[model samples]
Target: MVNRVPNEWLLYCRAGFEPDLTAEITARAHELDEPGQVVAAESNSGFVRWQSRDSRPANGIHRGLPLMSLVFARQSLVAFEPLSLSRDDRISPVVELIKESGWNFESIWHETPDTNEGKSLSRLAKSLSRPLESALKRGGGLRRKAGGRRLHLFWLAGDAVQIGMSFPGNRSEHPGGVLRLRHPADAPSRSTLKLEEAWHTFVPKEAWESRLHEGMQAVDLGAAPGGWTYQLVRRGMFVYAIDNGPMAPGLMATGQVEHLREDGFVWEPPYRLDWLVCDIVDKPMRVIDMVERWLIKRWCREAIFNLKLPMKKRWEEVQRCLTRLEVTLKAEGIEADIACRHLYHDREEVTVHVRLKGER
Candidate 1:
């Protein structure tokens, strides 16, 4: 048996997650790590915490950090303690296991109505609002020595809340609570931050910005409604939007986008593209083939695409695709960087990014 249990769990969940989905994740986590206590959790933001046990890792982040290396496996890491990735990066099964375990934080071992998973999220949120407000007042993710600072909160839909006080030291506080923010008196506009949560989950602004390739060219397959294209255009990149459906008026008006009424699978770019982005609601293999063809033919320098996931064995499916891509690329004597993550805006699918090894 373990000597001590964790005090809180910080769950990281995808953005815009639903209540039922959150419940399912909690139930699944419970099934995986049984009898252990769940101090707090959220379903939307793609994170969770549970009580520590004898079986849990002693040094939470020491063992839990390696999952960053293998995140493509389509599962999540459970950190028993807080983790800062700037320190360590490794690849080992045991390390991955420990990293996975630590994320399921250990809530306070108290017998209370809030201990129940169903209502614990709201209860925890109410409890921590006081401290969080204090932290915010002082400028979250910041130090007191610095003057007034901006407070940033990354709340998973139903997962754990991460409150960052940005000052010199950039202190971040996770008090195991759900976050509650009051809406403004007036209706927010497009540039306002109000709708940010709906578009992206606890995704760091840097991550989102980095994903954009400005001054780059892209090919959009089935780019109707232009959701993905909107992102690309905002970055100042021209896109070849290929779809039979009508694109959003805003995207079409940009004049940076070109509409082509052609089949995404058979269409060929008039010129080599800098990027290839697709949101085709097609089968996994078919999309995979397009990506493969692009890489093999060297049609594009980099690419970002989506894979609509199946209901069952989702993890295995992602693994298989990754493996196949790796193997194929290797056999072809090609080098590339690949990443797949469940983005804040994605649903039942994952966004994939690929760049040739040598290209910037």
Candidate 2:
């Protein structure tokens, strides 16, 4: 029978995205599903939280809900799925564990030719079995009927996988469609370890590179070693590399980058900037404050930054921050497009991209 799971983990990061931050990711896996037994989670870092209904105790410790609560309480489920594991060298143990589980294997969704070879079908099955069982156990006619179909695998990133018991109405891997990188030059290779791979999955290379206009100005806060700045410079945009430390020679040598050796919070741009980018290791509140200053003050025309989340109350805090920011911006008569995504390349942090309306 087929089972369905979450497409993304929405990794709960504590003030930054870290590849090793598996606990928050695990919590998110359980957080995504309704009636699933967490069969087994990868024991090492706890990134992979697998759930099934086949009499196995869901592995690892769930954060808030007790076992009884899941069984007895009317928990409002928002589509839970197990996290997927990815690394430079090792095969994800979750892949193996899912095979060990009794759930039948199925196809994958949104998988690309380059990555399709590495896809693990059985592993995804175990992670989704519990959720499927729940739908059947609940006697939801459509959901149960859907469960009878073959399973489908859709990898969201290293932190999450989307398991579908039925085929998607449309076969597109990116159901939301593609987000091309604003600049192709910004596409860092697999060797570029500093940037996460998932970012590329979310932001396509052709789109982004083509979108970058020649004279756009941008600022990179805390741009030491300049991994992100490298993307900007390659776009042929003038960038203010704001940080106290030295940027990589390659990024600096581009001449498109201007070193700004001042505190990100205290520094002011000489004029309005096209974009404000920050990847500082600080409290989410601080990042919010930085974004607020830019938005409320009209310091930049657009922005892309990261908000490092704290454990335990990540969703609440993100809501609070986003709500407050939206209110603040509205109060200031600013209109902008804002989005938060757990990019494939991001660890512990969520990326924010905001563009003010009516800006050319």
Candidate 3:
């Protein structure tokens, strides 16, 4: 029920990675023969817009370049309007514009930038959502059905706003492309949230009970303090927590984990394992080699690892490592679905989730 602007895209990404995202978007636009320019205000400002150079009408970016195929962005939308609301009552103008467009929305999300000032808008956005929905529903511009699309209100401020539309399954389910996860009080470390977020992203909840069952074996590389190990043992899986440092008392008391004082790089899995995890502060290439070995040699069925990035040429490093992994997987005739993300909780690193791809 929503309309897309011709050759315009709205991409949401992590803060401080705006330049990398801009480059990624421009490259894709060129490759698709739809060259465009990116309009961004500053670095680490959260979201950016892609302006198309082509005057001819087209389907925008959802035709072939799906959001999942793009690594730099967290979520993307096709924009239809950009307005300047320099008044106090913003809902009137926003509603009027949406009504004039002659489109309906299944839902509406009031998104803000991932900056300090942006975070302050949360209260205002919450207060505005109900009134906005009421206005849209009264004007017959809102429909809570699968056939309708979602409306995105990128509220940069009271005066600047962008109206975009995203189809279901084509955009992030998490608001503002940020996963709002709660930290467990008993969790060994903050790193636990990273693995928890990974589970929600790559694996389905129903499958977890079966796939990560009791007595299943797992290896936690560099698992000092046992953050990732905490998640596995909580699920009743037998974990080999490999680290030279001490672990949390609560984690060890569970009796589901065995602390191994050894180097993660030099040690090898005793046998095939269900899960192999790594979260070490090291070079990206070395970690890639270890993951490649485990997967190539069939030492584990699945893995979740972290790759530390150098500040300079960060995206280039991601692409280089990605290419290496893809090439090896293809040569080995192994079917796998690998997903990576610059998580909201992560800083200067990305979390990867890899699993065997079931044949059709």
Candidate 4:
């Protein structure tokens, strides 16, 4: 069993979403009966520090707040108090702290916040990472094995850091919870990265071959300029691109896409399709309603869509939409695996993926 730590929690998010993420985490903690106070939440900080009132191992906050279940937080870990390190001997103090914890880590990641200031610490992180690893190895605090805990060293400044650890299978695999993907040179637009990131974030890598294979039929709503359609074509799937706007000439030339000049919200697929993707810039509720109809009627086996959130109450709106969608689907006897994430490539929106259960 994974060891449960104390009350402190560290959550990372987008640069400008500190408030929203704090609110969401606070509300969630209350709902889980682990009410806590925010220790630090600066505007555009790209991170939040919260501590629960009850620090008991049995009632630890992380027990209720699995990182994956959270919408606003990109990464979450059990954190200790921030350390003020000596400029000349940063590695010794950090290494000593790990030794004092009496815990072994499978791997260590030197991370920073996702902001301009945070980016500036990259060089320092790189400079210290090698020596830190060497020290941990010499001290026997580092062990590479299955199911071992992962260590995190969060650099807040050149001489300040927050040390944490996360259980395997309970935290993001990427450092800082950001997956930096290269934009395809031939893609229609940057929006293509959103869909690509969605697939990587939501789908298990081992299941990709069967779930997202060649010759599958897909529909791309609001596919103007074919950004999303390009992904489908590249995957060897036939696409019905729904939009009155023009498509990319190169994409259309692939002979795999059929562009339909029609309003996406009004158009219906002639038959059930393998995939349904939408990037319509519409109200969150409207997008949710449309996606509901498609799933309720079994129009598609799976779906990936975006919900353009309002300026205010972004987290609340996301919860309402997700709750309504799940409740509606359950009421209709439809079982599905639903997931949503504020991906690296997404802004002002969240990507959602829904896959019907017990379907091949």
Best by TM-score: 4
Q: Is candidate 2 or candidate 3 better by TM-score?
A: 3
- Lowest lDDT sum, 10 consecutive residues, model 2, at 68-77
Residue 40 error, candidate 1, Å: 12
For candidate 1, write residues 260-283 as lDDT tens digits: 989999888777888787778888
Give the per-residue lDDT digits (tens) of candidate 2, residues 209-302.
Answer: 5446677898888888787777677667899988999877767666898998989987888998877878889998888988889888888976
Ranking by TM-score: 4, 3, 1, 2
Instruction: Give the C-alpha lDDT of model 1.
Output: 0.51
lDDT of 3 by residue, 88-206 (tens): 78888778777776778888989888888888877777888999999999987797773758888888876777887788667778888878899999998999999888787778778
Off by over 4 Å in 2: 1-211
TM-score of each: 0.58, 0.54, 0.92, 0.95
**Global lDDT scores for all candidate models:** 0.51, 0.51, 0.81, 0.88
Error of 1 at 97 (Å): 24
Q: For candidate 1, give the lDDT of residue 42.
A: 46
